[model samples]
Target chain A: MQILLASSFGAYLFALFRKEFIYAGVLLQLAYLLFRASELGRLPLVGPHDTIVFFTACAAAFSLPFGRLMKGEKAFGNIISVSSALFTALALVYEPRNFPLPPVLKTFWFETHVVLAFMSYALFGVAAVFGYLYLKAPQSLAETLQYKAVLIAYCLFTLSMIFGGIWAYLAWGTYWLWTPKELWTSILWIFYSFYLHARLRQWWAGRPAAVLGIAGFGVVMFTYLGVSLLMKSSHSF
Target chain B: MNPLKKIYQILLSLNTSLWLLLIITALFIAGAFIMPDNPGFGSIDIPLFDWLKRQNLESVWWLWGTIGVLSLLSVNTLFCSIDSIIKKRRVTHWLLLISPQVIHTGFLFMLLAHLLGASGSYHGEAAVAEGSAVKLSGGDILAIKNIEIETDDSGYLSGWGVDIEYNHSGNFTESARISPNSPFIYKDLNIMVKDVQAYPEAALLQVSRDPGAVWALAGSILFTLGILTLIALRMKMEKT
Candidate 1:
């Protein structure tokens, strides 16, 4: 309770000092990562959503530093807050377990594959948020940030497919089965693929780009959450 | 034409492509909604004849891969959109030329490989009883290399395990198992890990062929690297 309270307060304080806030928030997030690790010892992350929370938390911690890299408007502090809030909420929904993974997920590749997957998902999630804002806001400090966010997000979605394929090869005995999850995820990425296309094409700039952001992100949510609820999670053996 | 003028010209025409995508996605969504949730083992025959239909099976035609037509439709939307971007030269040469773009091109190749990749299948399930030899997906002979089953204190759905070894086309040997999760890949084929069925020594597995498997792999590797570079760059920027 105290740790979470302190972390929330720390985030609030950092929000006030947006300039230096990103770095301060990152350090605090890193501490929180350690804090969670200590409580559970080793990695408390297990299960589908559990891993998502764990990696998103890490990505949130890392995004601050990444946001800092952007040239002009450095509003990573805001990004961090959003990410942290998301992870915190996710934590409420998913509980970490110590149980061993099912047979198909018992491989070393499973850990690497899933960890990278959730991390990328987290990054995409942030990008989706920016995409949403980019479409709605006529123009603001976030415009430049939104473009950067899409570039980064598209990159992650692209990789998610790549890693997913490799992981699929190792576990499911095939790379692309066109399963609901795989099919939808690939479609989601393709949607963004064109979003990037449009953005670079510059003909469909701004609002069109933002619309892609919404459509692609919706697909992501569907692939990540909707699939499990509607169908299944993990490709299975 | 000046670059800006050319760019504007392209923008004016994006409307057609945009409307087309909207129509396609809407139909896809509506079709998905109307389709039955569970389309049981409907006849999965390569060439469809109405009488060939499996009885009581209602799986969506699209869900069955339907000769990959549904996927191709979606793929068409993606390709057209990509073409529009390319035709206009709006591609971010710098970013797209980097590791991220490599990831995209890799994915495209992988999908192509999956669709056009050379692959084969195995039908008969292999049941090995603690060190027995059996044939796998292809005609390749595989032996139950090892078998170890662990039961928890109560042993209620805790799961079981087994290991398998097989010889590939050119004497290449591979093995797979759960609990540790190391699946074997032989030549272009992958004989993934599995649990022994009733005997705790036999294994069940799925087999496939996608000649472009390597491209899928390459795409994944590049994607990871691209992500790392982007994040790492961000981390470095935070430091300064």
Candidate 2:
């Protein structure tokens, strides 16, 4: 898996059509995820290693559909490849130890919540990249792609939160928790909600909207990783 | 402008909504840092409003401020949504005109759910060994019938379940199994097995009553539907 990821990065460096390499990496990761799930009898999303890999796979898979639109834009491809490689490399730093699924995570809603959440995160990630590319070269296509990506991501993120609420209610008896992670998740959601509304306004239509898109991903990362590392939360990984 | 008309205009403006949302986002960002130091500040075992009242005002001022602003935002959302529909009532694109209002309504429903939950909810937990029973607040009884646990070769718990029998008014009612993710519900009450012990065969069970869960679920469905509908409309507009 490491070698395939490196090859994708190298292909991007060589100015080759890198979509195929990313697709290959995504396939390998998916296969590994399935194999681990079969071995453990549960979804392999418990630890940082598994989740980061899953996140990278989702980002790579979702980025492909925008490949043609991003053609002739070298910086766009470069950003995607470099970030993918950086994230996969970060995943490698974590020990991939197998552990039994905890009682709280033993739910259909939990898995659904995770899958939808990460997929939405991946879409937001792609939108952030488009936002950056738009900054480099102001193009209507880039802006449109960013808006559409955010629109889809917002819907999916809402669904993920819904599933997560149900799961929490079933296990913990409350739909909302006052933990750091939950707070940051709300912040992320509200930030995007702000972005959505900003687009509809005249003053914030272009560059400010693009900047919000970029910063929105920062909120995503902080909500996903920073909160876990910096604060005590029920989220294990 | 008349003072009443100015206040109404402020409540019905999208600008007010945007600014309120931004303020909420900032307050939550502050809260994400503040909450970790004040553990139990967000505990679900107690009613949220009561918990907030018991805390130090210095530490919990952000929370109070958030609640206050959220109330304002809710009013703003309601007013804006109503005003939009009235102004755009003649527009041919009916779905486009109503989608934002639907989203606003969903947001209001969610806020209402939180309000209901914060004001009135019940939570209780008990550890019961096999053959022992715990009396509930409502004079009902819950007895542990059996405990099952499955551990892996490394002694890690792989699976577990607790069988519980419910009695109402000193009369036998029903028997059910409770496990993680599978809570037993009787009326508005929910019973979940939080932990299990092996040698002595004991389990930690939590019973809770949430009056807002249905509202939350309804709000979520509406929120998702509104967003999806808006996205479809926007995409269609872009295509043309």
Candidate 3:
């Protein structure tokens, strides 16, 4: 708990200074998460709510690599780092360690498949954020940066659906159930597909696409978090 | 026209993508909400609603359709990956090879493996504790040993848990408990415990296959590189 607080504080402080401080923030986060991972792996966390918290934290962690890509724009790293810290803090608060995996998640696909699917979902979550920001640029402030984020998110979102289908097939008798979760994901995929096309067409520019990117992130959240709780499906969460 | 110019033009166009995404999302959202209070059967009188389960949160249609869309996506990806490789775009090769875009290529492989390479199957029984092997049309058998209905710590049922053995082609045998979350995998096939029936024998499992999973890992690495490259370039541009 103390470590969580410290990491959060560190992320904020790093965000403020950015260039010099973000690395330290990232390092602190690694320290905190690595220590906590063992404890986390023991919990159930199978339901939709639990998966959301778990996936969000992972997405934040995945964002770390973007810092290296973002180059000298430590602000990018700072943003990803602090946001990840914030997500972890939120998870600790709302998601108790008790959300154990139900019987459904015990399958090979549920454990490994869902984990990968959600991890990709988490990564896309960040990409969606960056995508929104990119499409909404004051003057395409960081066009390349925005593009990178969108591309990354697109890949993750795409993978999440594909892997999810495979997992669904293993769990259910069919590969495409089009349940709420699947529907939202397909919708999300279609949106990204268009976003990809938009990028090719240069239609939305930064603002509309940015909004869509942000919105895509929301859909990603719906697929990852909302669908599980609100809808009933054969899926584990 | 030079290929580079054509490439730039195609890459930069957004109208096609934006409108298509909007349409797709609209249809999906509409499909999601128009559900009956009681799903699975007709809560609504519309005959099409029968064909289309209530777009309820619990609708089976949503699940089935998602699987379909993803399967299509995998095929599309496979086609594009093949095109990218065969069309011999020097720039695309570098782009796909260097950027997270390559992950898309890997994703194609993963999807193909899950879709075509694995088998999805289900498990069920006619009555409780009948303990008979659920037979598959493919000649495999899932023999049951016991049944336990699982629940939360609060005792609300999460789902069913079955201790069963899977015999494949009469040569391979392994034991696993098929519950909602705890599925069994054999020979790359994944078996999930969907439901159990009392009177008529019924068992459910979702199956998937992907031959290109390892490539996704490689694509992830390339994606990280692409991200770094773009970020680095952005920072450099900002500084200058």
Candidate 4:
């Protein structure tokens, strides 16, 4: 698994210069996931290591579409490559362990919830990359793509939260919990909602909105990892 | 401008929502940091608002502030949706205009769900072994019939489930099995397996009543539908 992850990271690094390498990175990550899943006899998205790798894979796959949308902007390709490589490297920092799936996570709702949630996180990562591109070049295409990316990401995140709520209600008897992770999730959602509304104002349409887009990825990262690391959360793994 | 009209306009403005959401987000961030030291703020056994009622002002001011801002935001959302519907009643581009209103309606429904939950929800836990009966708060009896624990070949715990019987007033009612995702429900009451222990074959079960579950599901459906519609419309516009 570590070798595959390292190879994927190398492919993404190579993608910084050649766009075709992105596909190689994505394929390697997918292979790693499949191999890990076959070994574990379940989805490998149980801990920080597995989920981060999955998220990186999602980002790399999403970058293909987003890369085309950006009209093959070299900077866009480079940002995605470097970001994905960094995420893969981060995943490699954690020790790989194949723990049996907990009974609470054996539900279909739990699996769907994790998949949707991580997919949104990946999309948000793409949106933030576009936000960075917009800030660098200030093009109408970059700004519009940033908004579109965020819009889709917001919807997916909403659905993920809904599935999570249902799962929690069935498993824990409440739609919402008062844990730090849940609170941070709400914070991330509200922050994006604020960004969506902020885009309507004349003063915030371009640079300010772009900045918020970039800042949102920060919120996502903190919600995904920081909450687990710094606080006592059910999401801690 | 008339004072009432001014207030109405303020409540219907998009800026009001942005500002309120910003405040609420800030308060939530503060609460996240504060929650670690103040664990009671997140007690799962009691309703959150009820727990807040017992907390002093200084300790839980962020929560109080969040509730206040959320209330204002709800009112703003309601007014904005009503105003949009009335103003766009004649527009030909109906889907474009109504998508946001649908989102607003969903938001209102979710708020209502939370309100119902906070004011009326009940939660408690019971530990029981097989063949033992426990009385719930509302007079129903939960009798554990069997405990099933499954393990993998490596001796790692894989899964567990509990079989239970619900009875009322010395009469046999119904029998059901409760697992991780499958909860046994009797009307509004829900019984879920929280934990299972081996050797003695005991389980910990949580009983809860959430009056808002249906409302929340309704709200989630509407919210998801509205967003999907908006995304479709936006994509179409971009294509054209």
Candidate 5:
């Protein structure tokens, strides 16, 4: 699956270089998603490996319409394709095992929380890609796209946090824990809140907002991977 | 200008909010990275403010500062919401104007819930074997009736369930099945089976009373709805 995703991303790059190969890349992306879903017997969002693949799929899928919407902006597509490929490769490196779901995880809130959180992360990833593109090209459309993506991501992230709190309360008898993961998650949310508010200010609206968007993705990466790997916390996933 | 009016202006200042947010973020980042791991803080019964005060003052000065900033931010949020509502009363885009206030109100409600919970909540755990009773505060008692555990092929625990009977004033009130995801709520108390031990055949049940959970949940829902409404209205305005 990783190989196919990497190859599909390569095809996307090739299509960007040679404009006529776009359909081949799209077909490969769709095939990869289908194969992965079939293999997992569900959406590719169960574990770390699956989540990475799922995020890569989302980036590739969004790139199709985004690429078409912003014609002559092949760089945006290239950025997303490269990022997706990198994530897919990272997924392979992480090599998440298909452990059976624990009883605690077999809840509606767990699925909703994980899915929404990952979806928001993927959107933020895209926004970061756009932020980079905007810094390079300074297009109004890129700015708008980055803002819109962050808006949606913020909403989903909020919902994910809330659902997580509810799940925590159900399992642990506490809604808010001052664990490292929770702290970082709150920081990520606050950072974006600042970003959103700053975007409204005239001085910070354009390139500065783009910079914050990119920086926010760095925070997102740290929140997602850093706490899990670098720190000891209750969020074992 | 009157002193009270000056304070209100300061609280309503967006500049104050931005600065407070920055400080709070920095403090949280420091807490996440620098503070030693203390599992005891996760308990609902621990009053965070009291606990912070009890910590080594030198080591946790940042925490103290963070609390101060957060308190200020809460006040700022309240005043900012009021100021916005008053200022934007005649604005044609009522949805756009009010959505942020709704989010602010939700934020305040959540903060208030945390405050109420920190002072009034109770949390404790008890290990009870089958047919044993655990006494709780307010003269409540919980009796464990049965313990069921399901194991996979490798003898690993797949699932576990506990049947508990709530007794108040020595009278049986209700029975509940407590499982991993399903917690029993009796009055304001939540009873959840935390762990199961074999041989001894005991279940560790955590009981907590959080009077503010409902308010916090409602606040979260309202906050989410407010953001969605703001986004929808903004999108519509952009389209138009």
Candidate 6:
């Protein structure tokens, strides 16, 4: 399965360079995602390895629409391909196991919380790619794409945090625990909130927004992975 | 200009709100780094304000500073939201004009909920064997009827639940099964099984009461709706 994913990503890269096999590459990636989801018997979002693979699939899927709209379809595909390959390779580090879902995660709220949060992360991942490119090329389309992607991501992040809080209340009898994961997640949210507010100012619209978007992705990665690995908390993956 | 009007203008300034938010964010980051490393520091069982008050002010000045800045930010948020609502009252795109205000209103409600919870919430833990009764706040009693623990093939606990009966003023009341991710709520009180011991067949339960949970939930829902509305309007504008 991993080899198939890696091969599809390679195909995406080839399509990025050639610009002729883009549809075929997209179809291959989508098929791989479908196969993995069917095999898992649930959404491919339960564990870290599953989440990384699922995120890779989402990045490829999202690139199709966002790429066309931004007029940088090939560049977007290249970014998605690189990111998917990197994450899929990272997913291989964790030992594969068929552990049953923990009792605390056997709730609808938990599924909603994790899925929305990860989807937002994938959107922000795309935004960061465009944001970096905008910094390099300084195009209006890339700037607009970065802004819209972050806008959608910010909204989804808000929902994910709310859902997570509700799930915590159900499981632990508290909405907010102020654990390291919770605190850093709040920081990430506030970072993007500041970014959105700053974008409204005439002085901070284009280059500064791009910079912040890229920086916000750094915060997202730290919040998603760093806190779990470094800090002892209930959310440790 | 009148002094009261001057104060209102200052309060309503976007720059002031931005500065306040920045300061609060900084303080939060500082607190995250500077605070003592306790695994259970932020759990519901720990009353944050009460714990802070018990600590020496000189030692935990950052916490007090954070709280003070947050209060000022709340005021700033309220004034700015009201100012925007009044200024945009005549705009044609009412949804776009008011969406941010809806989010602001939600923020204020969540702050209010936190304030109410800080003042009135109660939390405690109790270890109860089967047929043991623990007295809760407001003179209510919780009686443990039975405790069940499901184990996997390796004898590791897969799941656990406690059957509890509530006695209100010596009158028999409702019974509930409290399990992981599922808590039993009686009025504003919530009871959940935290852990289980097999030798004596006892369950460690956590009990808490927060009157502001509903308000916080309502505020979160409103905030989500406001953001969705804003996004929908913006997307439509982009499409057009």
Span of 10 residues, lowest total lDDT, candidate 1 chain A: A1-10
Question: A152-225 in candidate 3: lDDT tens per residue?
Answer: 55555544555555455445534455356666676776776666556654556666666666777787767665
- Report the C-alpha lDDT of model 5 over B25-106, residue by residue, as the tens digit: 9998888866655554555255666676677665567777876898899988888787788888897578888899898888
Model 5 pairs whose backbones collide? none
Per-residue lDDT, model 3, residue A202, is 56
- In model 5, which runs have C-alpha deviations exceeding 4 angstroms? A1-47, B1-4, B37-45
Measured with C-alpha atoms, the lDDT of residue B117 in candidate 3 is 27
Better of 1 and 4 by TM-score: 4
RMSD of each: 7.0, 2.0, 8.5, 1.5, 2.6, 2.7
After superposition, candidate 6 runs with Cα above 4 Å error? A18-47, B1-6, B36-46, B56-61, B152-156
Show where candidate 1 strays beyond 4 Å.
A1-42, A48-52, A55-59, A62-83, A129-137, A235-237, B1-36, B39-105, B117-124, B135-140, B150-180, B197-202, B205-212, B218-240
In terms of docking quality, how is candidate 1 classified? acceptable
**Compared with the true structure, what per-residue lDDT tens digits does model 4 show for residues B1-240?**
999999988998999999999999999998888877777756656666787788777768898899899999999998888888898889748888889888888888998899888888878888899889898865778999999998888897777879999987666689899887899977667899888889799999888998888889899999999999999998898799
On TM-score, who's better, 2 or 4?
4
Q: What DockQ does each candidate score versus the true complex, computed on alpha carbons? A: 0.25, 0.76, 0.28, 0.84, 0.70, 0.56
After aligning candidate 2 to the native by TM-score, how far in Å is the CA of B3 from where it should be? 0.7
Across A1-237, the per-residue lDDT of candidate 1 in tens digits comes to 335424644563556455454345445545655666677444434655445545555556555645555445334456556556555555556544645445555555555556656665666666655565555555543455566666666665555556566666666665655245655565565466556556656567677666666567677667667776676434431
Compared with the true structure, all predictions reach lDDT values of: 0.53, 0.83, 0.54, 0.88, 0.80, 0.77
Q: For residues B83-134, could you state the per-residue lDDT of candidate 2 as single tens digits?
A: 7888889974999988878888888899998888888776888889999999
User: Candidate 3: global Cα-lDDT?
Assistant: 0.54
> Model 5 Cα displacement at A216 (Å)?
0.6
Best candidate per lDDT, number?
A: 4
Q: State the TM-score for model 3.
A: 0.59
lDDT of 2 by residue, A1-237 (tens): 445444544543343354456666677677777877888788888878889888988887888888677777767766776787778778878877587777678789999999999999999999999899888888888988999889899899989999999999888777787778888888989999999888989998878888999999999998898888878887865
Docking class of 2: medium
Candidate 6, residues B64-107: lDDT per residue as tens digits? 88678778878888888777778888974889888998888887
lDDT of 2 at B227: 86
- What DockQ does candidate 6 score? 0.56
